[model samples]
Target: MLFERLRTLPLRLLFSGSVALFPVSTWADTAAKVAPDIDLKEVAPVPRPEAKAPATADQEPSPDADEANPVPGEPEAEPAPEFVKTTRFSLLGSDVLPGTSTRLAWTPGIQIAGLSQPTPVLVVNGLHAGPTLCLTGAVHGDELNGIEIIRRTLYDLDPEKLSGRVVGIPIVNLPGFQEASRYLPDRRDLNRHFPGNPDGSLAERIAYSLFENIIRHCDMLVDIHTGSLKRTNLPQLRADMTNPEVAQFTRGFDRMAVVHSTGSDGMLRVAATRAGITTVTLEAGESHRIQEHQIEAGVNSLTSLMEKQDMISRMFEWGDPEPVYYESSWIRANHGGILFSEVDLGARVNKGEILGYVADPITNAQFPIHASADGRIIGMAVDQVVMAGFAAYHIGTEAEVPGE
Candidate 1:
């Protein structure tokens, strides 16, 4: 019902309640070559920031600031992320020299009886160094939106014109992606393991390998994901605002909604954040199928983030920023049955308003599901049969919303 997206832990992952893209050709050749970049139209574009004030005569631009609180009239801009061109970069035993791209394979720590299929990792090492940015998708095997997102984002970069490196692992869990299932063959949820143990469970080993070898290579990370368990989300960022660095990292995306969660234990975001790598979980659209708008929004957002970090320069037009939800909860179903949502994702609701209803298919008895508090619907169950106590509507509030 939510993102962290463990099918078994919806309620605990919820804030205070019970439960909570790809193309073909340059669009479909995923396994063999670097994906072809598609033309993406920005959902809401933000023009490039105006030039920053010059440094004083004796001073140079400083890149490390707790928060470069932009001065009112003549504010100094936040230093763009820096990369050392003198350093060499390598991945999975291969040297990726500057101005070049490589398609490499990463075999997980999992060892099966016969042969294990290797996962593909794409890398673009830029000519002018900046930072290594990692884009991971399909941690949940059934979620297809992220895989497509990684493809579009990675292939779009030109090594010669790029500043930093971009590494994309479209399918982190190949077994789940191959079977189109959310859980691994061992019935374990891969999302629950992070910075894994070499001598631990299979899921743990895989997590450890990725975290150690792949994830550690990045300056910042974006773990792309979508809604789970027949639910969907408006394009948004699931980030822990308590961490100063993590909080500031949320500002790069163009007007994407931010949901504050210190994040559940063992999630890649929490582990990576703990590892001192600024990371955020991006939740977009639903699982199982490809959604066009979601992919475009993801591509645009990633592009904007790179530009903000001075990794790329794409002047995307952006809208007024969206508010960050400090608190959120899942409004669960009191009666299990065929649930019909009366409201849509991002719909504003008043306290006690009927967001949807559950109707018994047999007796035709119906019960309306009302909001426990005034808020906006950020995620909800699709028109499907759900059981009592099932997380049906996810309401996010920035301070009691509009209604009392």
Candidate 2:
């Protein structure tokens, strides 16, 4: 009987497992007969494959997913747009000639330095499409090296071979240049006014307009100057070589005598540099007069710069240039008197050499001025009488020389 019940029990239990319960009277009798040796702890529920859990707020993102599909609470990355290349936008248009280059000019404008006086800037264009470069001269009216330089450079160039545009303002400060004075008609130093106010003083208006219009339009600039009033200088290029691009472009000026001048604030070079232009300042000859050697050197440097920039295809044969690179200092007069120079401009002098003698005109007493250090006499006073603290000359010394 028991064996027969056991065989049928599983069949009944399989279908009735959810609700199956024995009656109390029968379950008690069955429990008495059943063995107590079976272990419930030995049996474990079988583990089916776990279903995937829903994504949570703190879930990490997958590596392959696009950044746009960022996980919740993730910060998105935003990048700035890339820079676009510029095209030829010259004020002056060029005539396209077969197998030749293009020539251009700046849009002429009147700079109101005073109520009655006006200044003009002449811009030149090139045949090819490249960066705009500005060549400014006669900021100090007496410095004529750059004025003649621009003339020769323009007449000599052909447009068909040019790769970049050149903007030449032969006389930036026309009033000063015309009057042969270093300052404007207002007696204000034009170099000192920078980023000028358009509605401000006479010097300021010109400075403001120049900064806003032409300077803002160019990518590079070259400013030419001579020594202060009576002084002179060997043909040299002054620039900050710290910038990589400036160094690259300027290095092509083979005969350029490089000077590492600590540029003054608000000066033309400083203003141009601050405006992101690589600026080159050339100091050549004495004020009011142009030397042939200086002019030759200026032409060689200008051509070399233009050629290196691929502004023109014609390569110039420049003789070897000895670049005396230096940081410079000036020697000033200690006392006011009639002056007699022992050494002339461009001459090399040793320490203690009698540079000049200052004599009291009324007393007829002489004071001998000696060279403080060994250096080249880069500049000197043209006028014999000088007041104390007046800058007589600028000396280029050994220490002034650049190491690299």
Among all candidates shown, the one with the greatest lDDT:
1
**Each candidate's lDDT (Cα)?**
0.75, 0.62
The CA-based lDDT of model 2 is what?
A: 0.62
Segments of candidate 1 deviating more than 4 angstroms: 1-85, 399-404
lDDT of 1 by residue, 188-217 (tens): 888899988867998998998888878987
lDDT of 2 by residue, 42-83 (tens): 332231221223336799533211111112232322111111
Q: Candidate 1: deviation at residue 321, Å?
A: 0.4
Q: Per-residue lDDT for 161 in model 1?
A: 73
Q: Residue 256 lDDT in model 1?
A: 85
lDDT of 2 at 158: 50
Residue 120, candidate 1: alpha-carbon lDDT: 70
Off by over 4 Å in 2: 1-88, 92-123, 321-325, 399-404
